[model samples]
Target: MNEIDPFKLFLELQLALPRNAPGSARATREAFSLLPALPPRPEIADLGCGQGAEAFELLRLANGRITAVDLFEPFLEKLAERAEREGVPETRLRVLRGDMNDLPFHDGEFDLIWSEGAIYLLGFEEGLRLWRRFLKPGGFAVLSELTWLTDAPSPEAAVFWEDAYPGMGSVASNGEAAARAGYRLIGRIVLPTEEWWQDYYMPMRAKLAGMRRTYGELPVFDEMEREICLFERHADEYGYVFYALRRD
Candidate 1:
């Protein structure tokens, strides 16, 4: 028998979830509201737009056209389906399969760039600098990143994240990185724990249970379970933080 591909299994586990990370329509609107008035139907780009939860929210709030970019084709397909189901006009949303690091758009092409729970794939500071070129002067960029909430985290949480995301830093440090990347920090919002539970973890928990029944005993399953346990134990020490920035 052919061995199963664990990475493929991981992606399968994430499919069709409301969000791949913790966030809400409320949080997306809160970030957008901090921006200065946008031009009518401003151009926007959403990177790593998994299932386009934030993308749909952006369309609702700004009424802007969006180029939603992601590497996964399935996600883009799902976003397209959701867009149609919700009556988001085709002209308002365009789903593209592309890498965030090397976007296809030209310089200064977008009035706003938005990402949630995805910038970490490029490292926080690197993503800020690399993507800044795509923003028009005074254009806004909003992203939610994993951040250290407290100065000191518990040993278990620290170890897990150190292995998982060593680049993680406090919100203050992230703000400084934003400034260095030629963007002004407009505001920051700490995502409430309940949002994580409601949008991401709870659904993930249910999926994991089903996966366990099918996969039986896989190392990846164990690691995922451990992640859930760590969150339950150390949720207070760290969280996803939304940062609103403007190109200066």
Candidate 2:
């Protein structure tokens, strides 16, 4: 048998049918409703959008253009296919391959900036500061980030997240960072545990199982399994918090 690239296998499995993150259409709606009613045809940017689980919902709720950007070509391809299947016009939902760290967009160009479970590619505070320039003065940015839900996390959960996200902050800390990043800390909505299991993990379990069958004991499999196991044990200790902010 030929050597299978574990990294490639990992990436392939990440396209787990529903979405690439722990988010749902309902959560997207809940987060968007927090923002003031957007102008007609509001220009939005969904940066680091993975197959656009949130973006698709946004399209259904708002009649606007969303520029969905992601680094992975496969993810972009999948998103385009989904958009096409859903009869979305190319102009309405523009897809592109790009880096989040250095995006090609004008300052004050967007009415809203959205990212879910992806901004961690850049540190939370760093991403808020960097991406704030892209939104109009009154524009809003909503992001779902992994955060410490409790001040006192169990040692097991604390050790895991500390290694995974050393800069993870509590809601209070992240809200403060949003203020420091030149935005008003508008609101927050912690994702329900159902979103984690139903939307994200349940979909991924089959993929991990497939990978395990194909390539036994790969590091990626172990890493992913560890995360799932950890979440099952300590879901209450930490979670993805949606932070809604508006540029000052």
Candidate 3:
């Protein structure tokens, strides 16, 4: 028998899960409500659109065009399949596969740029600064990021995140970065704990159980199991926070 590639297993676990991270349509709508009025048929870009859950929600809310960008071709294909299943018009939804750090669109191309649970691929501040040029003047940019909610987190949680995401910052610090990046901060919300479990963790838990049965014990799977246990124990210390901003 061939040894299973752990990274491939990780990718397989993520396949078909709605929303790559902890988010809900309700949260998406709430963030959209905080934005200033958008033009009719506005042009929006969803950076790192995983399976396009948020992208579809945006389509429903804005009645506008969406350019869904992702580095993974499979993810883009999944989004395209979903768009077709929902009877979304081709003219309204476009999927482009490309690196988030190097987007293919020209400068000032979109009225709104949105990313959910994917901004940390570029450090939050760097992503804001780099992507700002792609937004039309006064256009909005919204993203969700992992944030340190409390000043004092448990040592274990701190160590785990420091190893996993050293650039994570407090909400106030992120707000400061937004301001420094030339965006007027419009709104910020901490996603509820239920959002984390319901869509992401719960399903991931089930998948992990099945994988363990198939693969027995492996270091990669052990690491993921530990991460989940840590999250369940330390949810209060950290969370995904959505930030809404408009270019000045």
- Compared to the true structure, candidate 3 yields what TM-score? 0.97
Off by over 4 Å in 1: none
The count of backbone overlaps in candidate 3 is 0
lDDT of 1 by residue, 42-117 (tens): 9999999988988888888887799899999888888999888888776999899999888898999999999999
Model 2's TM-score against the true structure:
0.96
- Sort the predicted structures by lDDT, highest score first: 3, 1, 2
C-alpha RMSD (angstroms) for model 1: 1.1
lDDT winner between candidates 1 and 3:
3
Per-model RMSD to reference: 1.1, 1.2, 1.1
Worst 10 residues of 1 by lDDT: 9-18
Report the lDDT tens digits of candidate 2 across residue range 60-94: 88899999999999899899998989899977899
Q: What TM-score fits each model?
A: 0.97, 0.96, 0.97
Those runs of model 2 whose alpha carbons end farther than 4 Å from true positions after fitting are 1-4
lDDT of 2 at 21: 84
lDDT of 3 by residue, 18-111 (tens): 7688999999999898898999989999998988999989988997899999988778888888888889887899889989899888889999
Give me the displacement of residue 160 in model 1, in angstroms.
Answer: 0.5
Give the clash total for candidate 2: 0
Which pairs in model 1 have colliding backbones?
A: none
